[model samples]
Target: MRLSVLGAGAIGPAAAALAASRGHEAVLWSPSGRGTMGLDGRIAAEGALSGVFPLRVAQGLEEALASADAVLLAVPAYAFPALLPRIAQAMPAGLPLLIAPAASLAPLAFEALRAGLGPRAPVGALATTPLTARRLAPDRVRIPAIRAAVDVAAVPAAATPEIATLATALFGHACPAAPDVLQPALANANPIIHAALALTNATRIERGEAWPQYELMTEATCRLMSALEAERAALAAALGYVVPTLAEALHRASGVPQGRLAAMGAAIAASGRAVLGPAEMETRYVTEDVPYGLSFYLWLAAGRGVAMPRTAATVAVLEVLWGRDLRANPLLEALDAAGLPRLLREGIGR
Candidate 1:
């Protein structure tokens, strides 16, 4: 299949390389238009899948998306609102649009704007990104690992089988069906993890102190993450799904010893994985994860009347630090819990 991969950051280039390795035509585009397009349309990748692969880097979004059988969005959560509308406009009807690591509320927000795009524009949200990757250089990327399994939630749930097949084929991971977008969205581990990490390390981040992120996850931070996890589990229960906590998720992903969630986090931190910390306070751990992630969790909790004091406190701290009301997300507020299941299964007004 010809795949149009958007956002030429860590995951995008790695995904393009993976597609090329699988004998699929993968064209890449950078919405920011700042990255170095590969020399002669080629990118060198290492780590998990190592090789110099041939890829077509498009000059414009339309050029990248045109005639593609599938579209994969690899941008951050904050970029979805602006980018998805442009993609919906340029993409031909019926093309499969997959959001890698579909952060909470992204699919709903996208579906809201994607009205009238027709049945062909089926959107699937993956619970997490396919690869743990980084840009090694302007023309190179390093992928450390692929997740053990992927949960995909498709709007109009009927598309789950096709999307699962395609996603598994493309990434060589077990792709399972999620009940609806809420299942996968709540299953996301980043917001809880990032919320804890960012809040605990706020002072260090402000001072530009650098350390391994996971290593800095102290007992206090892990306790906070566990509290948020409990709140998330309650929210998931209210929504009629069982979501795993961050520690269980880590154990499943990397075989971290399972006991206390904090110990699990400590195990992950001491695993010598070379994961780095945010050098500045204005990092995505607080920015993207706070507003688009934790705040959205609070929004859902409010609708369900589930108290998430820890989660709310975390986002509130971020709001004070960032000088913006992180909890005031209109898109999330516009989406009500009563209408969510139908909205996930169908579209906004359907």
Candidate 2:
């Protein structure tokens, strides 16, 4: 398979490298072009994925999508609005496009945009990224771990099995079909975990202290995360989706023992795979997750008449702390909550 991976950040390069390792041809493109600048058509990866692999760096979006069997958007959630149009314009029809670590109902947004462009292939999203990695350099990546399984869903819902098959083949892991796009949307745990970590450790971030994210998951911090998770679960239940609990998710992602949230955090911290926490307040931990992630959850909760005081309060406090309205998610803003449930399950015009 030939894969076109967008974004040059940690996940993009790592994914491209992983594809190459699996004997699939991969071409990588960075929207800004800077992410692939220093790489001379080869990627160096360590940890779970090791050694150097041959990689092609496309100079433009058109070049990247040309003759590709599949397209993976590895960019951040905030980049979706701007990049989706360009992607929809250039991508060849009938080519599968996937959003890794999909957030804020991005696949639906892309589906809506693609609807006006005429017939195209299925658009899908992963509940979360298949691997946890960090960019060691322009061409180097460190993959701490690869997930055992990933939740996948497609806009039309009927195309889920096909998309999941493609994902499994590409990543060499289990890709399970979700009930609907909303299931994957609600399955993302970053917002719930990051919100508690960022807010509780604001001082550490502001002071530029290097803190290990899981190590600092004190009892209070874990308690806050549990509270947020409860609210999120309630919202998911209201939508008739029973997503995994926080502990269950952590255990699956990191191979930590499934126990209390704090106990899981402790196990992850003791494991060497723990990544460092954000060093600055403006990090995506708050900016992206708050607006694109938590805000979307709140919007859905409101439509379902579900109470999310903890979730709402966290957003409110973060806004005050950052002096910015983090809930102004353009995707959510453009959506009508009353119609979203059905919209997420069925494609546009259904």
Per-model TM-score versus the true fold: 0.92, 0.97
lDDT of 2 by residue, 1-350 (tens): 99999999899999888888999999999999899989898999998889999999999999999899999999888888888888878877789898987798888887777676566688888998878889989889999888888889997888899999999889886887888788888898888899889999988998999999988888999999999998988888888888878887787778877898877877887887888999998788999889988888888877568999989999999988878889877766556667776777677743
List the pairs of residues colliding in candidate 1. Answer: 94-120
Q: Which ten residues in a row have the lowest lDDT in candidate 1?
A: 327-336
True lDDT of residue 54, candidate 2? 92
RMSD of 1: 2.1
In terms of TM-score, how similar is model 2 to the real structure? Answer: 0.97
Compared with the true structure, all predictions reach lDDT values of 0.78, 0.86
lDDT of 2: 0.86
Q: In model 2, which range of ten residues has the least summed lDDT?
A: 329-338
- Candidate 2 regions exceeding 4 Å error are none
lDDT by residue for model 1 over 215-260, one digit each (tens)?
Answer: 6677887888888888889888987888766865676555567787
Off by over 4 Å in 1: 36-40, 252-259, 262-272, 333-336, 348-350
